[model samples]
Target: MSTREEILGAAQRRLNLDPTSSMADIAAAAGIGRATLHRHFSGREDLLTEIGARSLDRWEERLDAARVGDVCSSDDADRLRATLVTLLGQYLEDSDDFGFALTDQFVLAEPTLTARGEALAEREIELFAAAQAAGVLRDDVSPRWISQACYGLLVAARDALRAGDVPRRDLDTVVASFFLHGAAAPGKPL
Candidate 1:
């Protein structure tokens, strides 16, 4: 691969392994000298900002490809369950950078994020509203809350994986199940 691609791939691996990995750590993993790494990335912040943008861009692309906007074609619950499993899979895969992207620094750096973020929020709200209308989802919370809760829970799950407490293979099933049914005993909703 090219030097930039090699560095980014190595850096992402380092970050996922340890979010606080140092530039020296990444350079070592990338198999490049510190000077070469610096020749490509002026500083750690510059590398991080670029990776955050790349992560956000990839995130948007994956969600867009999931076609969540047209998710009303079937039984809402079944479709939502399938959709979320796919989404959470992507979310977990990007655990390395998703946390940073949600931070203030990355949020402030990308002006386009606001518009895309608003659109995503609105789309999620619409889906939640539809599912609720279909009598699948509970009406206790607003669509906004449902969307935010899923994101919050996903982040928590990602952190748990980082801590080595959760098994990687079970992440998708566990996350999907929790989103579809949280704290509910068997067939009962709590």
Candidate 2:
């Protein structure tokens, strides 16, 4: 990899572990001098924005690879859920910082990310609608609502992991449970 790519990769890794890390720390992790790190990225915000953009692109790619549209068209709710869970798991494992950054309310508020996020939300809603149509999801639930809930669950999972309040082993189960059963009382048909 190019020096720039190496630096960025190192920065991303460090950011994922600790978003508050300093440039010097990132430089050390990247095996570059502080001067070199500064030469590459002049400011923290600039570096952060670049990282965010790259991470967002990666996430967009993951979503695309999920074939959400095709899956939704099949009206396979379980498949849709599994697709999301798998994509999310990969995203978390590959780029935890990106996941965390995207989940951050303030970062997501940025215009670019916000626009992309909205578009993604629309796509997710479509998937949710298809699942509902398939009778896998509750017909009473709105797609928009379900999409929002999904986003919330994703963020919660990230935060829970970061906080060490939830074990990593339980991540999949937690996400699945939320998406499948929801918060409603048990034994009631959805």
Candidate 3:
């Protein structure tokens, strides 16, 4: 791998493990000197900006691959559910690699990244709205809430995995179920 890619991979892994890790920590993780790390990224903000952009790119790619927009506009409830599950699975698969982008306020709040995230989120909200209109999702909750809840579930799932509270094999199913059926007891009335 290229030196830059090495650094980015190492930094991402290190940060996911310890968000407070310093540049020196990242350099050590990358097996490079601190100076080399700085040569590639001027500072932590610079590094984070790049990571944020890459994370957004991954999110967009996953959405497109899932054909989320097209599925949202379609009348096929089964397709919508399948697409949603696929999209959620993609995020879960990469949660460790890009979880920081979802959790780091600074990364999410970066002006450029913020704009990108807003656009992506708008698309997600549209999907949720379409599903709700089709009776595939709860109509009582706003689309925006559903969209945010999906993200929140991802974060929670990641935490669960990190804490060993959930097994890797069941992560996808558990997350999908919670998002679809929520935590309410079986047969409980809403």
Best candidate, TM-score: 3
Candidate 1 residues lying further than 4 Å off, grouped into runs, are 72-77, 96-119, 187-190
Would you list the C-alpha lDDT of every candidate in the order shown?
0.73, 0.74, 0.88
Record all residue pairs in model 1 with backbone atoms less than 3 Å apart, i.e. clashing: none
TM-scores vs. true structure, each candidate = 0.76, 0.78, 0.96
Ranking by TM-score: 3, 2, 1
Task: List, residue by residue over 12-69, the lDDT tens digit for candidate 1.
Answer: 7676666677899989889888899899999887887777667667767866787867
lDDT, model 1, position 93: 75
Candidate 3 local lDDT, residue 17: 90
Ten contiguous residues minimizing lDDT sum, candidate 1: 99-108
Cα RMSD to native, each candidate? 3.3, 3.2, 1.3
Residue 151, model 1, lDDT: 77
Candidate 1 vs candidate 2, lDDT winner: 2
Which residue pairs collide, candidate 2?
Answer: none
Descending-lDDT candidate ranking: 3, 2, 1
lDDT of 2 by residue, 82-133 (tens): 7767865775554445654755445666787678767767876787788778
> Residue 113: error of model 1 in Å?
5.0
Cα lDDT of candidate 3 equals: 0.88
